[model samples]
Target: MLLEGSTANAVGSQTLDLHRTCTKASQIFSSPGENFIQNKDTVKYGELIVLGYNGSLANGDKGRRRSRLALTKRLKANGVKPDVIHHISTPLVSKALSNKGHHSISYTLSRSHSVIVEYTHDASTDMFQIGRSTESMIDFVVTDTAPSGGGSGGSAQSTISRYACRVICQRSPPYTARIYAAGFDSSRNIFLGERAAKWRTPDGLMDGLTTNGVLVMHPTGGFSEDSSPGVWREISVCGNVYALRESRSAQQRGKLVENETNVLQDGSLIDLCGATLLWRTTEGLRRTPTLKQLEALRQEINAARPQCPVGFNTLAFPSLAQREVVEKKQPWVYSNCGHVHGYHDWGFRKEKGGVERECPMCRRVGPYVPLWLGCEAGLYLDAGRPTHAFCPCGHVCSERTVRYWSQILLPHGTHAFHAACPFCGTWLTGGHEQIKLIFQGPVD
Candidate 1:
C-alpha cells in the first residue's frame, strides 16, 4: 500500500471520476510512446494507463493535500525535487500505483435477525428509551449438529441470510512472460502479482524519487530453459496476449560449439541496447485451427446451407445481439452417490446423490464422507445432515464431529472425495471447508 517516486498533486480532483470510470476485468488503454507506469514496472510506449486497486479501501487510504503541498514546496525550496518525497496525495499519481492493478477484492453481505428485550428510554421516570433492533447482518454458514431434546418449545426464532461474492479477477490474455518472476498457480488456475519493492534506502534506486515504481512479470512457454542455437525462447500465446519465455541455453550452448567469427580485441567490451526474443505459441500446437482457418470456420458455421435430409434440431438458439460467452459445455462429473461437478450455470442435484457436501467423519457402520455441498459442515461442523461416508469397521457414528476432526481429515472444498482412501491412501488433513460456487447440468 506504500508508494514512492512521485507525490499525487490533484488529490480531490478527477481521482473520483477515474475510479468511477475504471471497472473490473477491463483493460486500461494508453497511447504510444509515453512511459505508462503500472505497479513496479516502468512501461514505455504507453499513451494512456488504466489504474486499479484490488483490496478494500480502509480509511487510512485517504489523505489531505496539505501534506503533499508541504513536501513539494520543500523540495522546490531546496533548489530541486528531492530524490524522493513523502506521501504525496494526488489522483494522477494514485492512478499510477493503483491497488486494484495488482490485486482484487470480494465481499459478501447478508442479513439475519436476533431479538432481545430492552427497557424503554423515558426521562420522565429515569428509564431509558431504547429498543433492540431485531435485524442485522449475520453469517449464513451452518454446521451439522444432532438435535438435542427440546428444552423450551418457545426458542427465539432467527433468520438465515445469504449473499453474493467472487474470489478471482477476470484474467486478461497474453500476459508478458517476464511477469512470472514470482511463481505460477498449480491448481487454483490463477496468476499472482509480485510484492512491492523497498524504496529510498541507501542502496535503493529511488534515492531522490518521491513516488514508487510499478512491478510486472509474465508467464508462458514450456518449463524448460534449453533452446537450440538461433532459436529464441521468447514467444507469444494466442491473440499475442501473453508473452512467454523458453530456454535457448542448449541451442546457445551449441552455437558456442559451431565455428564463429569474433572480431574483438582481448581488452574490448561491447554494449547492447536490447535483443529480440524468439518464442512459439499455441499456434504451433498439433494441427490447431489456424487464425485464418478459425475465421473461415466461423463464417461457414453461419452461412452453410442445409441438405435435403430429415433433421429435428430443438436447440436453444441465442440472439446475436445479446450473446454472453460461457465456457463450452461439458458433462458434469459426479460421484455415484450424486455429488455434482461444475457446469455452465444451473446446478442439478439428485435427492440421493445430491446430498450437501460435508467433512469427514466416522460412523459405526463406516466412515462419514461428503456426498454434497456443506458436507464438511454437516458431520464435522455439526451440520444436521446425512451421515454419508462410513468406516469399514462397521460403526455408524451420527454424533456431531468436531473441527479438529476436519483439520485431521479433509482439505475443504475437496469434500466430494472419500474421507479415507479406498486403497493404501494418505489423508489430506488441513483447514475447514471453504465455500465455493458450483454449477451442474442435466445429462443430455
Candidate 2:
C-alpha cells in the first residue's frame, strides 16, 4: 500500500479510497458534530498533496488526537513513515525550501487508496526509501497539523505558507489567453493589441503577473460575469469613463456604469453618451512589476467600460447631419501658411481675409507653427475661441520675449498662452527652438 522514491510517479495512476480518508479526516477535523468535509467528491487522489508536521506544542484535544491518530494509523496501516516534518510557518517553509539537500523528495500515493503524499527526507542517497525500501516501504507522515490546530483537528490557520507555495496542477491551462501591447503608434494613430500570439495561462493556477499578458480594452453594456468563478472584472486601466460607474466595489466589478449586469458577459457593445473609449492595461499602469500579481487582481475587479466606441470619430450624440461641434475642438494649421486656424474648411477668400501677419488685436505675427508646446505645462488656447486659452490663472502670453523672460524669472511658473498650454499659461515654444538651432547643413 506504500510508495517510495521515483516509484511515487505511480501516484498519477493509482486509484484512491478518498471516501475512507475523507471519512476519517472528517471526524478529526469536524467541529463537534458538524462534518466540515461537506462533499468528498471535490477531492481527487491524483491532486492530493498531503504534508505532515509536528508542531512545537501538543494539546490533549480529542479532535487533535483523532486527526493525528487517523493520519498516523492510516500511514501505519499502509506501512509508511513520513519522510519529512516541516515547521508550519513561513520562516520554516522558507528554510526548508531553500535547502537543496532534499534528494528523497518524491510524490507518491497509496495502493489501496488513491492519495498523494509528498515524501521528502534528510540528505542521503536512500532518502526517498520508505521503511528502507525505495519501492514499496510505507512511511508515516509526521505532520504539525494536529499541534497547530490546538489539537482540535479543525481547519489550519491561514498563513502565507498556505497560499504562498500552494501548488495546483491542472489538466488544462489555467487561463485561455495571453496578450501584450506590442506597440502604440501616434503618428499613424494605431494601437496594436497583442495580435502576435495565442496567449495561455501557465499549466496551473497563477497570478496575473506570472501571466503578464493581458489587454485592457473597454467593454460595454453591463457587468461581465466570468465563467471562471474566482476571476472578477478589473479596471485594468481607467480612462475617460472613470466617472460613469454607478457604484464602485469589489462585487460591482465587471459591471459597467449605466448598464445591466447581464449585458457584457462575454464583452458586448452599447452607447454611453459622448464618452471616448480609453484603455491602458495593468502592465501600462505599473511602473514596476514587483506587485504585478495583486495589481492585476485589482485591475480585473475595477475594469470600466467605454461609453464611446473607438473607430468612430464623433463629437455629437445621435449623429449630426451637417456641421457638428464638440465641447473641445482644436484648430488645425492652414498648411498654406503656418497658421493655427479653425478645423472647418473656410472658403479660400474667407481664409485669406483672416490670414493676417498679426492678430490685429494681439499683434502676434503669422508664419507661426501650431503652438501646443506650452501645453506640456497644461496650458493651451481653445483653438476655436480667441479668448483666454490658459488656466484660470490668466497667464496666456505668446510673446517670445515675455515667455522666456517669465520662465527665466520664475523657473517653476507656467503661463497659459492663447496658442499655449491649458494647465500653465505659457506660449507654445515648439518650433521656436529649431529656429535657434545651428544651421549645420544647406538652408532650405
Candidate 3:
C-alpha cells in the first residue's frame, strides 16, 4: 500500500511509482546495485538515486528511500518545492552537513539516519507543521519492520526543526545540563557540596538516564547501571533537555534541590538523594590538548623572567619554620634600622606598570649587602654557627630593613605582590607569582 502522502497532488504520479518501486526494492533485500535512476529531471533524478539505497539495507541504510520520499512529500505538501534531493554518499555526509543552508534539507541513513532541514522562506509555518506532524509520521522500517520509538525517524524529524534557530545562530552543542549529586563529593558529605555546577551534554542516553526520566539517586547511594522507576523527569524545551525533580519521590531533603524544578545551566548544581553532584559538559574531553600546546605554555612562563639568571632576587630570610634560628642561620643581615623579614612577606610599592622595592621603615634603597645585624659581638662566642642572613644575590642589608619591608609591602599587594630584582629584572612574590625562587642559602 502507498504511504499517506505518496499520492499527494504536489508530487507527480511518476515520483509515486518510483517510490513504490523503491519500496519493493527495499523488500527484496538484495545487495547494493548500481545507480538505477540517473535522469536529469530533478524530481525523477531524486527518486532514482534514493531508490538505489533501497536494494540493500546495509547497517543503517534501510528505509532510506522511504524517509527521503516522505520528507520530499512533506516539504511539497507544505508548499516548499525541493529543487533537488541528491542521495548524499556516506563518505560525503560530513561535507554535506558542513555546507547546509536554511532552506536546504539533507537526510541520510548512516549510523543513525540523520535529517537536518532549515526553513528560510515565509512558508516556515508549513515547515513547522510538517516538522511536528512528520515527527510521528516518519518511520524507519528495518527489514520491513519499524523499530521501537520509530527507529531514528523521530530523532531526525524532531531535532532539525526544533534546533533550526540555534543552527542559524551557529551555536554548537546547543544543549547542556547541570547536576548535583552527593555521591560525587569526595568527603562523602552531601551538605558540603561543589561551589559551582558542572555542565554536560544533555543527551538523555547517559547511562541511567532515559527518554522519560533519570534515576535521581539509587538507594545504593551512588549511580548504578540499573535505573530506578522515577526520580526525575526529563523535559525537552526547544531541543534542550532538562531534569526536573519529581515530587512523588520521598528522597528530596538535600540542599541542592530546594525548588520544584531547576533549569540545568552549565554551572547549576543539583541535589540527588541527599548527595550533591555537579553536572559538567564533556566538551573538554572531546578537545584533548596536544603536547605542543603544553610546551608553548611552559615557554610562555619562562619568557616572563630575565634572560640572565644571576642577578635574580632570592628569599631574604630563613624559612618560616626556622625563624627562631635567625641568629644562627642569617649572619649577614642588613639591620642598621632593625627591620627583618622573610621572602614571602616582602613586596614592592606599586609603580606605573610594576612595583619598586625599598625599605619602607627607614627609606633606604637596598639590595642590602654585608650589613651585619645579628647577635651582639660576644653574645654567642662559643656558638659554632653563623648569626646573619644573606641574599641569594649576595646583596645583604640590615635584617631590620627586610622585615620592615614585609610589614609595609604585604598590605599593599592584598592578593599578591610584585617586585623586581634590583640586580636583575626578574619579578618575585611570596608564593608562585609569574616567577618565584626560594633560597636555601646565600648563592655561592
Candidate 4:
C-alpha cells in the first residue's frame, strides 16, 4: 500500500507501542551558524555540535594546538562549553564518510551518546557528526586550504577557525500525520503530501516527496473558496503533531465537513474525495521500539496470561493416509486437504515430519503453515517451544527467524530497506538496530 503520512501514523500507533519516549522526527542539518563576533560564532539550542579540525597543521603539533586554542577562545566568547567532545582518528573519519552512508557515524554517536569531531592528519579537512531527526545521523565535512607562512624564518601564519557548539534541549512530543489513498497498501505507503510555506502546492508535491515533511493540501482539488480563513487548508500546527482540517460544507457545493479541531488525536480518520486518510500524532513513527520496551510488552502479555488459551488442541497433526482417519477422543486433520477426520473405521497414514510430509489424498506439497503463525519458521512455537525474540511489530518467533529477517531486511539505502508485520501490516524502518532489538532478549 502506498502510505500517506496520515495512514501510516494510524497503523503505526495501532501496531506498535503508541506510548513511548518522545523523540523528534524532523532534523535540521546545516553548515556552521553565522559568526556573531569578529571571531566568534553562535550556537543554537538543542544542537549537539562537534567542532572538528579548527586550524591548519603547517606547524605540526604546535600549529594544531594553536588552532584548537583559538577555537577554545572563540567558544568561551560564545558561552559554549564543549566538554562532552570525542576526538576521532582521521583515517576512521575518511573511511566512514567516503562510503556515503550514515551507519558508521550513527553507530559511533549512539554507541557513545556523544558528539564526534575529527581533524585530518593533513589538517586540511574537518568532520562533524550528529543524530538526525530520524533514527540516523548526518555528517558535515569541512575542507580548507593549507596554512601559509610569511617572511622571517617562514614562521607559521595564524589561521583562526571557529568551532561549532550546540545547546542540548529537552525533547517534546512528535506530531506526524499519515494519509492514505486508493490502491495503496502496507508495502507501498510513503508520506504523500506537499510541504508549503503557505497554502501553495508544488506542482510535484503530490507527485512524490524526497523526504518526510508536513503536507497540507487537499487531495483532488485546487484551493477552495469556502475554506476557513487562514485555516482553510489542512495544516500541521503544533510541531507537525496537531493538525487543522478546515473546510466549510455548503450542502450546495457538495463540500462536507466533520470532526472540527486543531489537535490531532492518536488515530483520526478523514475521508476526502473517495480517498481514506487516517491521521495520527505519534512520536518517532520512523523509529521502532527499543529492545527493552518490546521485551517488557512481551513479559506483560505473558504474565497477564500464563498459557495459551487454545493450548495444544489447536495444533495440527499431519496425516499420511490416503483414506480419512477417525478418532472419537482426538480428531485427525489432513495437512494438504484440510479435511477433518472424524470418528470412522478407516485408519490414517502417519508422516515423519510435519513440514516435509506431503498429503496423500490431494497429492499437494506440505501445507506446513497455520493461521496463528503465518510461516513454517514459526512452527516451533506451536510445538510448545520457548521463544527468545519478538519483532517490534509484535510477532513472536524463534531467535533464528529474527536473525534471518534481520539480514533480509537490512537497509540498503535511506529508504531502500523495510520489513512489514504480516499480522498487523505495520512497516518497520529503523533498520538493523530495530531488528537487533527484536532479538536482544528480555531484560533481567
Candidate 5:
C-alpha cells in the first residue's frame, strides 16, 4: 500500500492532531481519585506492550513512542466505518475524496478505474494505530527491537510498515477490541495498489492485506499460568482471519480461518514483521503480578544467599532500575547445565564461533552469561517463583513465563521464524530454550 499527501493541513479547520487529543484523554482517564472526577466512570479496554523491553525503552518512554500504551475510552470517538463506495473513472474525483480529511481507503484497480471507500465517524468505538511511522496518526510508534534490551532503534533496515495496522475497540460493555492489517496514513487514507493482494468476497465486499502483513496469535487458553501458544494467523484490512502466507511478502493470500476471528484476547501476540506486541486485557492484568510483587520476588531471591561453587562469592540479581549495567556480584549461569554461580574470570574455553566456558561443577562447556531478572511484570505468566532462565541470553523469569515464550515461534526478518526470549528478544538456541536453575546455597 502507498501513502501520499501531507497531513499538516489534513484536518483543515478542525484538529488533525489526534495524537495530542489521545495524550490528553489518557491523562484525564487516569487512575481513580487522582485528578479527573469522571475517572470513576472511565473504562480501560487493555494495553499493548511491545516485546523485548524490560519495562520502559532504553532511552525511556517519551510521547507516543513507549514500550506500552493503554487503550482507554476516548473523550470523543475517533473511529470510522465504511459508509459510501465510489467507483470513479477519473483520477480527479478520487483525489478529491481522499483530500476531504475524513478516513478513506483507495483500491486502485487500474489507471482508468479505481474504488474509493469513504468512511464516516463511528461514535460507538475508538481507534488506535500502531506502526514504525512517527506521524501523528500512529498512536503507538514501534520499531524493531534488538536482543538484550538494546532498544527499538536497534535495526538500521526495518521491515515494519510506516502505517502498519490499526485496532478498533467498542465503547460500551464487553469492550471488544479488533485488529486490522492496515492503518490510515497521515492524510487519513489507506491505498492498496494494483499489485497488492486484494479481492472481492463472495458477498461482493473489498478486502486486502498490507505489504508484510500483520500476524496475531492468541494463547490456547487465556493469558495465565496454564496458557499455551495458539496458531499464528494473518489478519486482513477488513478484519478477517487467515493462515500465514508461504512467505512474508507473498502476493497470494492464505486460506481463510473460519473458526478464528480478529477479536483480541489476553495474551494475544501481534507481529508487525519487524516488531511484535503483547496484548494484555485489563482483567488479565488484574490477575498478573504487580511491580511491588515482582520487587519482593527479587528481594526474596537475593535473601536466599546463593553463592558460587568456584569463587564462593555471593551473587545477587540487580534491581529493575539498573537494567543495562551488569553488577560484579550478579549471578552467572552455565546455560548448558543450569548451574548458577557468581561472576568469575576463569572457566574460559576456546570455541570457534563465539566465547565458550566450561562449568566448574558439571564440566559442561557452553555459553556463560550473566543472569538478569525479567523486570517487565506484565510478561509474567504467573506470580510463580523465578526459577527458570532462557538460553543464550540468560534473562530469568517465572517457570511458566520462560517456558511459554520458548515454545512460541515469532517472525524473524522475512521468511525465517524462531522462538525468541520475550524479555530480551534473543533467538533461542539449541533444543532446550529454557532450563531449570540449580542455585547453590552458601557453603557453610
Candidate 6:
C-alpha cells in the first residue's frame, strides 16, 4: 500500500515563530525586498544536507549544487501525482506521451507492451528533485563523496543516477514531506526499462525501483542525542516502503514493510548509493548548535589554554575557515589512548606501520592524526561542548555527536555498510569508534 498523509494538526503559534526565524535566516542570503516579499510569506519544510562536507562544497556552494538545500514552499506548487494510466503497444505512442511536457513514469513490461502513468500537478505541495543531474528540474545537484585518503579521484565514475529521487512536501501547516524513488527528467518523465525492478501492486497500480534504488533510514527516536539508528528500507516510485533487496541492483523486490511509510522524519538518512543526505526539520535545527554557537565553543576551548606536555606549547583549534591548513599551535591526538599533544615527528613505531606512533604520555601506540573541529553544525545532535573525537580520522565534536555518528552504519558501496566520520568521509577504525580526549592544561 502507498504511504498515507500525516493527520497531525497545524503547529499553531510555533508556525509563526518558525516563519520569523526562517525569514531572518533567509535575509542573510537574499535581498531585502526578496527576503520580505518572497521568503517571509513562504513556509520552510526543512533542509537536506549531504554528509562528508564539513560546511560547504570544495569549491564552495554555488546555486543548486550546494552542500545543503532548504526546502521552502514555492510561490506556485510544482508537485505531481499519478493521474492517468495508459498501456501502449506502439513504441511511438509511448515516446510521444512522455514528450508531451507532463510528468510521467513509463514502465516497460516488454518490447511491445508498456505501461505509462501520467501525473498531474499538485497545487497543495511543493516538489524538489535531487540527483547528479545538471538538469533544471533537479533542485539539488549531488555528486559522489570520496573517502579521505582513499585516492578515489574526481574523475572516478559515479554510481548515482542522473535523476535519483524527488521530495514532495505539503504546502499547508504541519508541512509533511514524502520521498519517492526516481525523479522526473527535463522532459518531465521517469522511465523504468524492462531490466529495471517494476511490479504491479496488490491494488493493480504500477510501481518501480530505480537502478541503484533510493534507501532511507529514519532514526528510531527523534533527532536528539538519545536517538538510535532505525532499519534501512527501500522506497518505491509510489512511495511504499520495503525491506532492502538482496543486492542493490537486484531484479526482484524485497518484502513490503506495511508499518513503515515513506514519510521523512527529523533524522532521516537518505542514501543515493553514491552520496548520503541528512534531513533536519526546522524544529530539529532549533535544537542543534548554530554557527555562532560553534564559534563560541571554539573560543571557549581556546580560552582554557590547553598545553602540550612534551613541547610545553599551548595548542589551539584553528578557525573553521583555516581548518585545512595545520596551524603551528594545532593539537594532535594519539587516537588509541586519546592523549592530546602538539605535532611531533618522532615516536613513529616502525614495527607497527610508520603511521602508528607511541604516545609519550600514556605509552599507548596508535594512529596519530591532527584534530579538526567538526564545523557542520547541522550534524551535531546538541549544542554540547566539543569533547570527543572520532578514531582513525580525528574530527572532534560534542560527545553526543561523536557517539551518534560512531554508531551509525552508513552505506559504503553497493552492499557493504560502515561507520564513517560525518565531517570527513573517513571510515572509522579501532575497537571503539571514538575516544574521550585528555587535554593537558597550561603547567605555568
- Backbone clashes per model, in order? 98, 51, 39, 24, 0, 0
lDDT by residue for model 2 (258-375), tens:
2312111212111111000111122222321222332342233223211111111222111111111223222223222232332343233334465523432234443322322221
Error in Å for residue 245 of model 5: 1.3
Please tell me which model should have the higher TM-score, number 4 or number 5. 5
For 1-444, candidate 1 gives per-residue lDDT tens digits of: 133333333222222221232221111111011111244332211011001100101111222200000000010110101111112234344334332223211111111111110111111110000001111110111111111111112213211101110011111222111111111011111111122211222322111100111111112222112111121111110001111111211111111112211111111111000000111222222222232443343234223321111121111112222122222221122222222222322222344365423211111111122221111111122222223222221111112222112222211121122232111112322231211111222223
Candidate 4 ranges beyond 4 A from true positions:
1-208, 211-444
lDDT scores in order: 0.17, 0.20, 0.24, 0.23, 0.81, 0.81
**For all the candidates, what are their Cα RMSDs to the real structure?**
25.7, 27.7, 26.6, 24.7, 7.4, 9.9
lDDT (tens digit, per residue) of candidate 3 on 287-354: 32233433343334233331111223332333222222333324222233323333322434455233
Better of 3 and 5 by lDDT: 5
Q: Quick one: ranking by TM-score, best first?
A: 6, 5, 4, 1, 3, 2
Per-candidate TM-score against the hidden true structure: 0.18, 0.16, 0.17, 0.19, 0.90, 0.90
lDDT value, residue 226 of candidate 1: 17
lDDT of 5 at 257: 92
Off by over 4 Å in 6: 1-37, 149-156
Q: Which segments of candidate 2 are over 4 A away from where they belong?
A: 1-90, 98-176, 179-215, 219-444
Q: Count backbone clashes in candidate 1.
A: 98
Cα-based lDDT at residue 95, candidate 5:
86
Error of 3 at 289 (Å): 6.8
